[model samples]
Target: MVSAENSSLEYLRSLVNYDINSILYDDTLICSLTNNTDVGSFEVKVTKTNYGNLHDCIQVIANSQATIDGVACGTTVRAVVTRELVTVQQEHTEYVKLPNPITRIVDFISESTDYVITITNEEGKKKTTETKRIPKNEAQGLILEGANLILQRLMIQRNMPDKVTMLSLDSSSELSRNVYTSLGPQQVNINGKDIEAWGIQRQIFETKPNALPIAWQSFFSIDGHLISRYQVGSPIKMKTRNIPEAEQFDEYLPKPEIPKRELEWENDLELRSRFIDRRDELIDDYKSYIYQHPDINALLSDFLQSVLITKPENIIDYATEFFAPFNNQTADRSLFRFADEKIPVPKPNISLK
Candidate 1:
């Protein structure tokens, strides 16, 4: 009797008989980069083709536009992996940076040497390094490694490579060596279903001598689909919250302090003009209050945070209880105290009275 494991292995081995293995890589996939929070997300189509710009190369292209910050932001990524005779060359990538009203393209090619150039921007007029490219050695490029990972997964149980060295292109001065080791096949949970996946452990080694390597684990399906990736020590966190119902607490909000005019005794025209013109003194006074007592801003921030977390029936009452602790001070004293908040006013001598 053939067990499920043996059955899967047998099925994978059978794919090598003909050219039917193209289903795994040569196709289009609609993928989303999102988390449990649903806070920020973008979807794109990833397509893999046998024929690319360069000769004897396979290409993966992802291009799409999504609304970000209420503006349309477009993203385009093209990765090419070339085969030079017997050996596969490193991958070349051209990708757009996610941005606001404008976006720019940046690419990394293995053949080019690394350097930094400085220039000044027209707006800031600050001289900055115009561009930077990471130094590369014999390490494999990420795009090529991803393609290799997908292709090699077909022969996981038979001819999978023991380990491979990859190049790290993070925003750091020194490029680290990422060595990935195959940990054989294992069962992984994806979308609440247990699916078979090939486990891989990556050790990121710094350029320094005798430095320890940081470890990361990843799981991928036999078809080269990435299931999950996580660091060894850190635990992944996923949180969800329900949408809050409507609540009215406008009365509890801060009101601008109406400045008492000393010129009222002299019957000045300022207060008369204030009432007749109605020149939005509340707005001006509110701005002045915000400038003077910045603590009010922190106070309101804390109240809003508590309201968001608790989501009580009466947000006004919740705010009262939240600020109740600091309300016991005298009228003359500071209304609230923050850790770094201080006022350096010399005390008046009691004998002056």
Candidate 2:
């Protein structure tokens, strides 16, 4: 008789064989570098492919138009493993073509259990380094990049309790293990609708004594969609109201144009001019880092000057993306408060003063 755990792993293997193990999700997420949110999208494809003698392949690509470290960046990560999901190969590339041109590509190959990492520079120079052999469990469970959907699926499939230690493939270092504690299932409201989700806490610990671990909480829907994610120290959040079906969107379509009129504050001529001017300034400085930049005070001063402009009712929807790097709710409220102060109301022609 096959155990439930074995049955779950077997089911995952079957999905890989038919190339049905894939997910596409879109979201607005905060960038840690800019401290602002953007229309971030993630696509993950896992298929059965023949890479040398290995056949399982996993690819993750993420893109955001927001600036990171003073540059617009996008990343694609590819990982190949055996049927059991043990690492056989991994590769990552980061491309930044706006404001500045920068590209980094690295490859990791597993040979006799040890990993050899090779990095290629723009000059085509190659550097190679080696890391000690990773444990089979760590290699099998390493998450290169993607939604928590995969992890959540496995957790629920196996009925795992307590915590699970999964390796984070963010870096080649062996210390990137993320320990996730399952908080069980909870009910949450999404888009004014109630839904049941699995809440999980992810923590990254350091080898140093008494050091604080980077931690965050993530929630996934029963159908394996990552619905919400929150981190400490910042009120920023990431959520997807719906999980998109595969191939529902076309990738080669022409990019849509931004609506100029939507941002124009026409009710007040002065407000309209100021709002338009500020929007132009932000577009000009789109490449600049918003979080603790070298001239942060000057940048904030200029940004504060624009706060007096009359904010549109839909400002919250635009502020998260337009503010580029400001705290989301804070920026939204400041605009609202500024609008309240500037817009005067006549009280039925009655004066009390």
Candidate 3:
């Protein structure tokens, strides 16, 4: 005669073959017993794959109608268990088209005689007319480099400058007193190579009173005909924002002065332990609050569902790609490899008595 344990084991083994094995990296497990007979209670054991180690094994009390087979079976019994996976693979791909380059230069004059340059190319066009405060000695060189850098940065932001190199500032001459006297091209050594460089000559002037002067000059390139020339100087007036005055906290009270204190070396371990304990307490409190507030949980679930449903797939792709570099293996495993192993399913255990 087959014993009840043997029969139950056999039944469980058969059910394991037919029961759908779902791969849920991080999800909740829901189990419901619709029918049973002569069963007072049941035991379930969960094991980890690859390791074959027992994760959790426990027995659940049967309900009023629940039974081993059918006699002691309960009307309806349900169990929900949630497990968190250490690693997960979420794949995403994005297709981007490159932009054109600037072929023409556009001139923009500010209200205060500040000249700005905009370049248009095959891929796209970029313009910068606002005057940026720059040191007089490095103004021209920075203007050349900064403008191109700004455009390149913008293209990078737009995800356009892929596999293409644009003309940019290679080297610049420093401002010197000699620049005021010498009107000829200056010999500069750049990257272990001596080259005759030219552009606008930079000179320091005492009369200008906090202003630097840059004189337009010519450079002798390897091919010879002066490649670039520009003169940059101080602006007559800088633009500023109008901020409203903040209201005084006390109309007549005098402002209090704070006394500075010297640094002290307290017990770091104790401090850290206190902080961690406080943090854990706060987190536990929050979880308890959430558990007590079923309405809030329902509202949150609804909000999350709505967000996931209404979010554009492309925007998610873009955001994922943008943050892919920063996420760790647990967060962004898909970015690094194709055949990464899936996270193992956690065993179900009795978390509460």
Candidate 4:
């Protein structure tokens, strides 16, 4: 029961069948088990309430067994999605004790800052945590497979979307495809107790970019609990089930293997519609450089302000006097002091004609 005086979130509040505000505090821990996939069985523990410093954001932690180049490997993924107007950001990460093959990271470009935390234990061992200040545009169409609840609002409203592209992180690589959605009646039975649910079917298109889509269905209880998931004719079933000791390795799984310097896109569009191949180091350098100087940022900001405010024709000459008195000097520190000091605008030389 949350109301917004600003009405910014009132619309979102109305759209969701369940309480958005209360969902963040629900103590229920939902777990899903996926078995018999090409790789192996995996368990995912979903925390709807709290997972990180960003209170009330969505978090998904998955533990699984995978094979890379035919060798068995254990994998873990902790994906954090900070709430936005529509989509969310996955730019925040903390320390992990175990090793993994890959971890997908996405960023929205902007001025940035990084804060690193290190803790030393009595045994002289240290654990490090990392955080950053990031805010940017909400990615409109991209979706996460593990946190499909992001679509709960639309699902409850019975307004399923179609022809949208979908993206997900697998144990070792990324999986993506075009998709379409449809709604239907569903009756789920757990040990013979039938529970009414909403059946949302999705057709995933990897071949021909959707000429033929593989049928996938997700069933949710009326109150929006993901009760079960099934691919049309596949034996792999993912539903709310307990897999003991799975959540224990959430933080201690092996560190992710650094992706190759070059990226291998699943399709051509994915390859062309990207910026850098892999430049985390360069991005860190950029944030570090910008964080070092707040004064310079202000100085340039004022210069640009004066440029627009004055609208001087000879911009180079105007900038020269924007902070009037070239040398370190008198009290005329005013930006566009020429205007503030009542300096006259340039008068054009016109001979009497």
Candidate 5:
């Protein structure tokens, strides 16, 4: 006789089985970022190809690329296999070339008892680890499969508990149970049509009870597909779109370059903390630009600030609107005006006309 916990675990394991034939048939999906306050608007295209053979062992291959501010930030590819309702023998690579160039490659090969993870980065950095044998019910490996796996797990346990612990391949922290509160059926307007989906409040990272919860939310379909996601109270919502072929994204994937500086940071806690603070400050500076020009889409700032050639007319109206409120001629205008035509009209008719 199976206990309730065991039964639930078994059900969770079944949903994550990588051998799900329907999901592997040369599929393409487009996910686009949507929001007014979003720092950057981006799109991700994922493609999956299936190689149906036993000897190949590398049964499924998935490729994903994300572009932010009209530039390719990174590309990831994964080769995954399934055995006994568990995804194993994953080969993965992350190529990042935006802001800086970095390449991270991970290979996980299954042994009799456990799996070994070998990682290599662009700077000739390498690290290897042996993972404990994952139980049938556990979750691990590439996000292409892990996302769907976790979604299925959450859908199954939606009514059971508000918080549940799950395993992960990440080494920064131990496996922790994340709190999830259902927002119930939300009416999502997609492409001008209303579709009902379940909303779940998620903690993007672990935080103390008294500390602020970095709120992230995901909306899932009745069939447990993630249709949309965003930070709570944020206007930005990333939604899914249909794609004809995965090859459509090939042109957008840029070749990665290695940076000159040492990419690896030394093990210094205080220095790391200060570095994190500096990083946040840089982000705050980016936010200042957006805050100053609220009418302009934040995504356009990259083009306005970086590109040598631009249609200034496209952004001139936004700049005019942003400064219109502060247009008053508070300062002495007579001393500064070379042509009198540049003077303010509202303030004592300073204009010569």
Candidate 6:
């Protein structure tokens, strides 16, 4: 009779032979198959973490066969596997909002200086610095002042140049050489009213004569074509009085007789005489006006307001009320008094007057 262990081994071997897919193995067979002595069958199932609700699964099976007394046997195995779920948190990126363009333009105009720009990230966590040279003021102070005046005039109607391009100022004259392009007519509503205003195009060029700088101004139509050119300065030579020959001789007796020298002497003498005569006449007129009229301060104030006030129309009512009683006579009287205080009475002129 067979022992229980032997019967069990015989039963396992019989099972291996009964199954067509299972191969039989013995001590010798296992040694011949591979170096490892232990052999077994296994089943594995793999699962991976899914980003969303859906998850994926994989299945694998491994097996080894053994035989005893010409009998084959195999053991079945199984496993269920799942991957560790990993969670990732996304990072948020911050953005920055720039300053208001209108406020920048207004500040540039009022200060009449270059602007320093500062950028701040959202939540005020960090800041960056930037520098920009405002074209309006990059030129010398005089040109900047003039440009401010022009911009102010346009600002009243809520209009500005599309782009401002600054060129080198004339080295000889220190005048701005800039070009302004008009983008086009922009419709703006103010106080519940619609108004149409002309868009202007401007270009600056520095030209000759250090004493007189040229301003080449241009205007643009709504379509952006150059419509007009305004040439400023190019000061016309005013006819001055010619010096008498005797006066020239008396003035230039000590100077050399070269043609250029003679001409220069005559010109210098003529200019000097003209300047002296003008100064004397101004003084006489000022004194006479002051002596004839005592209240001149008020007239000066009025003249200043007329020339300097930007919104004359808006202040006209107030000005009329202020000057209601003061006619031209009062104005003249006041002007005369100012002149008298400013001008000194000459000895010869005092006796004649």
> Each model's C-alpha lDDT?
0.46, 0.55, 0.30, 0.46, 0.48, 0.33
lDDT of 2 by residue, 82-182 (tens): 54455567767777665446667777677765566566545234344444444444344454433233455445435555766655543334436567788
Cα RMSDs, all models? 31.0, 29.3, 44.6, 28.6, 30.3, 45.1
Clashing pairs in 2: none
Q: Pick the candidate with the highest TM-score.
A: 2
**Candidate 4 lDDT, 180-277, residue by residue in tens:** 45566677765456777677776544433324456767776554555666567654465554211211112334689987675456456656455444
Model 2 regions lying over 4 Å from their true place:
1-39, 56-65, 68-71, 94-106, 119-143, 146-149, 168-172, 208-211, 230-236, 243-353
Worst 10 residues of 2 by lDDT: 1-10
Q: Estimate each model's TM-score.
A: 0.38, 0.47, 0.15, 0.37, 0.44, 0.15
Candidate 4: where are CA atoms >4 Å away? Answer: 1-18, 21-44, 48-55, 64-77, 85-139, 157-180, 207-215, 239-353
Worst 10 residues of 4 by lDDT: 115-124
State candidate 6's TM-score.
0.15
Clashes of 6: 10
Residue 166, model 1: Cα distance from true site in angstroms:
4.2
lDDT of 5 by residue, 1-353 (tens): 11123344454465544333323233333444553333333232223333344332324444555665655644354544443324455666767565556677666655555555566667335344433343333333222233433443236334424443333343222223344456777887666777777777655333334544456677656544555665566444566553122211123336889788764454778878889999999999999987898866854564455434544655767555544544565434454467546756665757688
- What's the lDDT for residue 239 in model 4? 54
- Superposing every Cα of model 2 onto the true structure, what RMSD results? 29.3
Best by lDDT: 2
Candidate 1 lDDT tens digits, 1-353: 11113333343334444232232333222223344422222222233345433454545443433343444444454555433211123322222233412333344444445322222222223223345543333332432333433444344434455665544533232455556678888986545666777777876665666766667676655654445554566433211121112222234336889998565623657777667555577778789989999999898898888788888998778766776676655232354345477868898778775
Q: Please identify model 1 stretches exceeding 4 Å from their true place.
A: 1-36, 39-53, 62-77, 83-106, 110-158, 166-170, 173-175, 208-216, 231-353
